[model samples]
Target: MKSVGVIIGSIRDNRVGDKVAHWFFEKSGVKKNLNAEILDLKKFNLPFFNEDVAPMALKGNYSTEEGRHWYNTVKKFDSFVFVTPEYNAGMPASLKNAIDYVYPDWNSKPAVIVSYGFHGGVNSALSLERIITDKSPIKMNLTNTKPKLFLSKDILNEKGQFKNIDQDFEKYTDEIKKSIEELEELLNTATANK
Candidate 1:
């Protein structure tokens, strides 16, 4: 089985990214060849990318302890699912910082983006896809099926807590499943070539 990291790309307090990530993990885990785990950015606590040298220059030998730990964990995953939230129509700074902390580990790996926001976070997903695509240094083999998750005020209270995640997100399950299938296909193909 190929290991997949379902990364929660938000680190802010009271963020909804974890709920989204957990749903993705559960959905993806049922696949016969996938071993999925949720990687919460808050738990990693990576500092802002302040290394003197760029991550690409380090070639997997990170300078900071946090960077090294994050890299090692990421290295184990054959593919990834990025569960992100749109902040100001873009991905959160914490997600960007985490991505900046590693290079080769992300290169050539297949990944899917699942973004949640008012308008389903399409802009946020695009922003991340641009960074991880052929145009950028990360160069992850991204899946075309980018799933957009929307939040409705009716389902959220005044303080922004979900009354029922499953009920609110049921509509997006098919897209999420398609994304997993695409990721699995890519992972299988990559493994075959190697």
Candidate 2:
């Protein structure tokens, strides 16, 4: 079976991205062909991308220990699911920096973006998609069924933390499942071709 990394793209304290990622991971359920694991950026705590050469030029050799470890962990996965939150209508700087630290590992691999915000986080999702698909040299074979989760006040506490993920995101479960299935299909194709 192929492995899928579900990345929690936000690293802010008390962020809602964690709850969403956990919920998505659970919803992914049992997969016959894929093994899903959560890759929390908060836990990784990667430093800012300040290498003298861009990641693409490094060819998998990273200058920093953290960068090298991150690359090693991510390269094990056959595909990914990035669970992100919209920060001022764009992806978080931490997430972008993390992506910038790795290259070649992401090339031609399948991925899906599951974004959340007050207004569904469509802008952040689009920005992330463009980065993996066009902006960076690392091109990911992204699944078409990217799930945009809408976050309303009812589901969040007064402090902006998620209160009930299953209730708030119940409507989007089908969409999330579709994204995973699409990625599985892509992974299957890649495996067969290899």
Candidate 3:
């Protein structure tokens, strides 16, 4: 089975990113083919890019302990699902900061976007794709999830939970499964070549 890192990009207190990621994993039900793990950025507590080096790759000296931890965490996964929140029509700075902390770990891996916010976080997802492609050269899966997450209140139940949202959840779940399957195939091909 292939391992996928489901990265929750929001670092805010009481954020909904984790809940949504968990929901996606549950809905996907692709454990036989893919192993999914949620990687929350808040736990890393990484500082801003403060290294004196002009380029991060040459020095590779992470300024703080959090940076080292974050880099190690990122290196563990072969693929990623960046669950991002739109902030001012783009991804949050914390997510971008986390991405900047690592280099080679992100290269050659596959990535998929699961974004949410007003306008379904489409703008943020697009911007993130550009950044990831430019920096890591990772394959960006066409299958994506862009839930209109602002409707959480309406879709969620009385216990503040969203168990099912009609056919939308099913559709998103199918997309995730397809993306992971493609990623697994790509990973296998890459491994064979090596």
Query: lDDT of all the models against the reference?
Result: 0.86, 0.86, 0.71
Model 2's C-alpha root-mean-square deviation from the true structure amounts to: 1.6
Clashes of each: 0, 0, 0
RMSD per candidate (Å) reads 1.4, 1.6, 3.4
User: In candidate 1, what residue range of length 10 has the lowest lDDT sum?
Assistant: 24-33
The TM-scores of all predictions, comma-separated, are 0.95, 0.94, 0.81
Instruction: Please say which candidate is ahead in TM-score: 2 or 3.
Output: 2
**What would you estimate as the lDDT of candidate 1?**
0.86
- Between candidates 1 and 3, the one scoring higher on TM-score is 1
Question: Could you tell me which 10 consecutive residues in candidate 3 have the lowest summed lDDT?
Answer: 139-148
Q: Please provide, for model 3 over 1-194, each residue's C-alpha lDDT reduced to its tens digit, 9 standing for 90 to 100.
A: 67888888988886667777777666755355777788888877778877765334534567677877887777788787788988898999999988877777777777767787747788898778888863435434333433434444666667655556544356566666666666667668767888
Name the TM-score of candidate 1: 0.95
| Model 3 misplaced stretches (Cα beyond 4 Å) | 54-60, 134-153, 156-168
Name the TM-score of candidate 3.
Answer: 0.81
